[model samples]
Target: MHSPGAIQPAELWRLFMRAMAVVDYARPLELLHVPAADIPAGHAWIRVLACGVCFSDVKIARGQMPFSSSLRLPHIPGHEICGEVLEAPGGFWFQKGDRVLVYNYWGCGRCPMCRIGQENLCLNLQGWVGFTNPGGFQEGLAVPPERLLPLPPGISPEQAAPIGCAIATAYRAVVTRAAVRPGELVGVIGVGGIGLHAVQIARAAGARVIAVDIDPRKLELARVFGAVAVLPEEAEETARRWGDGIGLDAVIETVGHVHTVDLAIRMIRRGGRLIGVGYRLGDMASIHTPRWVLEEITLMGSRYALRHEVEQAIRLVAEGLVRPVIDEVLPLESANEALERLERGQAIGRLVLQVGSFSGV
Candidate 1:
């Protein structure tokens, strides 16, 4: 590890590090030695230990997301990151060898949303870690100290990685956005990575969670996560039946497809809420305007998550209230294979990449 005060920013840039980069659109990531960017003032140099592979990473690699067109070439894309602090500026809360989970997005800090601690909903957006900024597919990262959340003692780097995205996003949707209460009938649409976590979070929040998915494997995993699993064809009916013939009190939509969004809307009872957590770039869902108006149904979109919510998720894992379902953990070199598996819908839960070996502190 380099001493914090010994190396200057320009000198840091002269060093090169290994990374997996997207050099062109719709192409495989190339393993290359790229110049290390300077760790800015007030930031820490994090040695990445693990990174969870999100479907958005796949979408970006395949040029499916709208923002893909604007990304600088050779972009490294793994946002759900876990790492250890290798170096830090003085007076910061974090120090060398401290385990941390990264919050992957940033905002203009002065925006109204940011002022209120909702940086994920910032008006003048800065960048996303894996989207607009260089991300954790590399061995090391330069991250702002405020974005680093300490990993609790019980969580390993691999176990804590997905908390940065999947778990944190689900916690925000179920607990914060939807405000799922005890005894409320909550339906989680699409039992994928984030959806499964939503099921666990809602259940932990004392709600009866009904999980809907087309894949039997995922439905079974949802059952293991404390939800009543059902097929998509049976979701609306199941929710209605469980809600005393009305519908669910809230529906958390993790599959942002048009049909799933439509199904989520239909599964909510009068005065209920539909929280959209998953999304594609241009996909649109049709809503019956009159029906929604008369029934008082609410449609809301949940982006990533708040910073404090990430810490809450870490606590949830620490207390064993929720477990992030990881289908497999592969080496960093297998990122392309991980992406291919996720794109094909073969993964039952979140897939993670072991960036570097780090025993828990």
Candidate 2:
């Protein structure tokens, strides 16, 4: 957050009590200040708790994946976060000190898609926190009140921050997209951040879990998270065997690698589902889909989570049914290092950014 260039704390703080911005290509991820901003009748200004450094953030920083051209420059990149209320605008269930998880995606409130409970696909999506607009990587996040999901008890702020994206995205992959069933066999590809959570959520739903990853360390951790079987990266036979020779009932692909997708598709049974949720780091590679189509294996793509899914994720964590593997919880000052490690695929699990918890961690 240190400014080596035209440092102007006075000017920035005048508009916001404190400002947080991560330079995408040519500026520093900065921290500044400003007088409070106006909260519309259905909105609130929230004090941030913690933010999960997403792979998308790294892509945005490296300019590997481009943002919308319409988006203004000097954009912030955090999209997974949990926080508390700084000020309320009334006419909502929220109150001061209410622990909440921010569903980063906000859409046109009254749109047909939103009315049907598909805000993630709203045509006029207003964008996410810290990406297309202001986000929770700062001391506070000002957003429409509707985007907030009140956190359940027994979940600390820092523990809940990564839940909105990582955990909820996994939930959607299993519960909604994959539609796993009790006593069914489910394969989760890439046992890193998202795959780790996906394994647990699938296991929680009464499925026998098989986790795949290139790293043995991640595979072992997946076992610890209730995975019944841990398969190596190239183990297509492992999946087929686990699927009882017919192929698996469901496979959640969190890795975008083409070879991995091919292996996962080969492991699905007739009428099985495959849920994919990863980005093209650089070159966009395609996976072969003839086997999937021939076998009637369903394929579903999941992105960000909606408010209720995030709420459900919080409850799961608070109840001890699921817990995030915080490989390293460092302060916001060390964000660049965290992002670098994440980009290298060296992180075992979610790398949480302790924004205001500097003194503790």
Q: TM-score of each candidate?
A: 0.94, 0.88
List RMSD in Å for every model shown: 2.9, 4.9
Q: Model 2: per-residue lDDT, tens digit, 309-355?
A: 87788778878888887788877667778778987889988898876
C-alpha lDDT of candidate 1 relative to the true structure:
0.88
lDDT of 1 by residue, 282-323 (tens): 898878888889999999999889889999999999999999
Which 10 successive residues of model 2 have the least lDDT summed? 1-10
With a 3 Å backbone cut-off (N, CA, C), the pairs that clash in candidate 1 are: none
Model 1 C-alpha RMSD to native = 2.9
lDDT of 2 at 297: 67
User: What are the runs in model 1 whose C-alpha is more than 4 Å off?
Assistant: 1-14, 359-361
- Give model 1's TM-score versus the native structure: 0.94
Q: Candidate 2 overall Cα lDDT vs. reference?
A: 0.75
